[model samples]
Target: MMKNNVSAFVKAVSLAVCAALILSASAVFRAQAEKTLDQMQSELDSINAALSQKQDDYDSLNAQIGEQKSRLGALNSQISNMDAQLDSLNAKIRILNGQLLELNKQIEKLESEINVLNDRIQQALDQIAEKERQIEATKQLLLERLRATYIAGNSTELEVLLSSNDLSSFLTRSELLQRVAENDDRLIRQLEKEQKELSELTRALAADKAELVAKKEKVEQERTSVIVKQSELQTSADAVHKKQNEIEAKRNEVNKILATLDTNSEEYRRQIAFYESQREKADSAIEAYIRAHATTTVPSTNEDGGTAPQTGDGMAWPVPYNNCYISSYFGYRDLYNTGNYRLHKGIDICVSGGSNGKKIVAADGGTVMIAGYHSSYGNYVTIDHGNGLVTLYAHASVLTVSAGDHVEKGQKIAEIGSTGDSTGPHLHFGVYDNASGQFVNPLNYVSMP
Candidate 1:
């Protein structure tokens, strides 16, 4: 009987030892899980910080773009003003050219008038010379007559007639003497009158020619001044044109800068979004891990109850309906019409009727790797199929799985809804090739029902 009692005591001690080991293992597992969660949380915090910094950078870039745009606007306005000034200068130049033309015409007319006056003066000079010659001739004739009278000793016409050889000679001599006296008087008077008239005409012509020459000089001066003014205006216009070209070139450079800035800002925004998504995924993963490990046995069924349709290849469509439309395809997408493209890492699914509250199913049987909320993905789930293939379902109203939970194909894992960064109720489904370390086209693995 003592042996039996000892054996029972031994068995009891062994039982106690086994129970202690089991409890210790459980405690160790819980501690390890907690430590992992802490590490993940730390990582999430780091990601959050990075996301914030990126967002700040994006904001700064946008501010810079705004400033550049303002500068561009000012430059454009300046260019407009410059253009107006150029136009005014051109108009002035044209008017000056017209004025110059008129001045040239006036100069030409004055030159013609001066030429005419010169001809008149020359004619007057010739006439005066001829009158002087006639006056000299008349004076010579008068001298000769005086000398003849002195030689005759003041003899009368009868004495002159007695000197004749006969009566006829005497009569002829008398008549000749009378005619010479009359001719001398008339010739002398005419010569004086002609000399006076010629002098007057010469004076008039000289005066008129001098006046015309002065007028011509004045017109020429005005023409020279107009030409100089036109040249100055042309110089100003040329300077303005050069300045405009320079400004236009500068504006073009600014435009290029703005384009580059816009591109950088967009890239930064995308990076921030990616970081946010990662952080949220990590957060949800931590929560799911905690929830899943809370119990001794992990639940195999959907945690958030729902029904889903199973349709497609080994990887099935994530949406409840097979007829769901693909709102966006996986690849580069132009979401903002900025002439810039962003990578769409997943396909967006929209169900018939209202997509909100529609069930989301796993594409294949796999272990849940992550189940959490994200700023970009909203409520999301990531399932790890055997091998390097993984599937993701995002933008859900509700998540029905936790990390570490086993999910079967077509199992309801979430409900579709508009969540963070979503435009409407839809499912963002993605396939990731772990081996390649890149998200792939989900359509390559799954087919439309």
Candidate 2:
């Protein structure tokens, strides 16, 4: 009997030692898991920050593009105005060209008139010279006759008769002397009149030539002015065209820059997708680790040292409110009425009176693995029941528990409220099977209250 007792005592010590080793190892594993979770959370936060920065850059690029487009619009408007101005300038050029052509014609006509006047003046001068020669000859003849008369010294018809050989001879001499004097006098007067008329004609022709020359000079001056104006207009038009080309080149450059920005934006989107995928992977890892090492010691007794109430499958309903109904069911559905389908992953519960401020309890006795705010789940609590079973109560307004807190089944852990991705006040109750590594229907474990 003494040997048997000693054997039993030795066995008890061995069992106790084994348990202590197991608990120590578990504690070590738990510490490692927490460190890993921290690292993963840090990585996720870094990814999120990077995503936010990329989004800001994308927005800035878009704004720049918008500003560039606005500038392009202004440029186009300026181009349009320039085109209209060019058209007007060209029209003026056409009109000026026509006027120049007409002026050239007038100048040609005036030059021709001046040439004709010059020819007339030359002819008049020739006529005047011929008349002068005739006048000189006649004057010489008259002077000689006058000298003969003077030599005769007061001779009359009686003297002429006295000098004649006979009466008939005397009469003939008298008639010839009279005719000579009259012919000489008439020729001198005719020559003098012809010279005077030629002189007048030459002077008139010269005046006409001067007038034509002045008209031609005026026409030339007008043509020069028109040419200068046309040249200036052409220069202005050329400048406008140059500006248009420059603006077009700038526009092309901007378009190329926009294309590059688009490409960069696409690359940013790809990076965001990769990071989001990494975040999902990290979330899976966190869920796995939490499930694996969530509970070390599960107390058999409740806080009051009494047995907790449980349903048929070892889980109690999370909501104790009467007349509560399932607003949404688990599985795939078009929750947003969009064509895309998404997994519900949980059941949403609401009471008849109102689900606001409703109490949310733990489904079973376990340790709280997570009790905090989530972007999608709001104020939520995750409980780890032993044997790889876990429950999540999400979209709560108030949290009554914290992480690592031991909770009993039917113990209030949170209050129902419309937080996060919710349409109204309700409790999103989800059940995860860590053994299967997937979420299961909560209805499979807990019955409706």
Candidate 3:
């Protein structure tokens, strides 16, 4: 019996030593995991920052494009207005040309009239000269006849008295001679007056001709001005067209940049996908470890000796198997605080003895709120279980539920992954109180599988 007791004691001591070594190894692994998680979180933060900066750049470029487009539109409108003005100017030019042509025709007609008037004036002057010459010749002839009769002394008085047959008859003959001379003088004066009137008419016609020439010159100048204005309008139109083309080119450049950004965003999404797969595997391993090692009796305090609250609504085990281990724990942990600005709000679990791609079941029935990539959570899902309760699963390689979908307790919602701020395959599980809008330790609600 003593030898049996000794063997039992040896066996017990060996077991204790083995347990201590395992715990020490686990601590070392935990430390390594924490370090890895920190690195992942740092990279994730950088990616997020880059994404934000890219988005800002895109928005700024878009705004610039929009402004350019608006200016282009305004320019187009101005071009349209210019076109209308050009049309109006063209019409005015046409009307001016028509007026000029009419004025030219009128001037030509007036010039022709002036030429006829000049000829008439010259003819009138010639007639006046001929009349003056005839009058002078007649006066000379009369003078010679009178002088010869007087010099010859043809006994005019006695003859004249005998011819008259009385003194009174002789006196009547003398008076008639005087009246005939006066009538001849009056006829010459009338001819001189008619010549003067013809001279005045010629001078008036010349003045009218000069005025018409000046008006014609003015019309020509107006037509030249119209032509210059048309050229200016054309130049303005060309400038507007060039400006519009430049704006369009700028818009195309912005669009090209945005396209490139979209490609980068897609690449980031792919990286998130790959990491999620690894995280899921790690989570499954932890789950398996916890299932094998954890006792059935619920501990009053968690491993950290913190009493987590227990809410009755949908509180249950997440998995059916035993031997699962928590690879990470929740709340203000630095490992997942890559931004160096936020706390880690979830716990990581790995089924230490399970195969990869193991199913990660939902803790309770709920409606899926998210089932896709969250920049920080990676491939993740959130479920609103109603009544102020929400459950979150992160680093999932595959999700079986989507937003707005119903799920029952123990439903397989996703597979484990190492996505997002994770270094290895694991599950990041969280419980949120809808009332408080705060994260609560999920360890309070779910037991080790």
Candidate 3 lDDT, tens digit per residue, 224-280? 675566566556656655665665576566566656655554554444444443444
How many angstroms is residue 122 displaced in model 2 relative to the true structure, after the best TM-score fit? Answer: 2.3
Cα distance off (Å), candidate 2, residue 95: 2.9
- Candidate order by TM-score, decreasing, is 1, 2, 3
Candidate 1 collision pairs: 284-372
Whose TM-score is greatest here? 1
Give lDDT: candidate 2, residue 228: 98
- What are the TM-scores, per candidate, against the unseen true structure? 0.61, 0.54, 0.43
Prediction RMSDs, each to the true structure: 8.1, 11.0, 15.2
Model 1 lDDT at residue 299: 18
Give the clashing pairs for model 2.
none
Candidate whose lDDT is highest: 2
CA lDDT of each candidate? 0.79, 0.80, 0.63
Q: Is candidate 1 or candidate 3 better by lDDT?
A: 1
**223-258, model 2: which lDDT tens digit per residue?**
999999999999998998898888888878877877
Clashes of each: 1, 0, 43
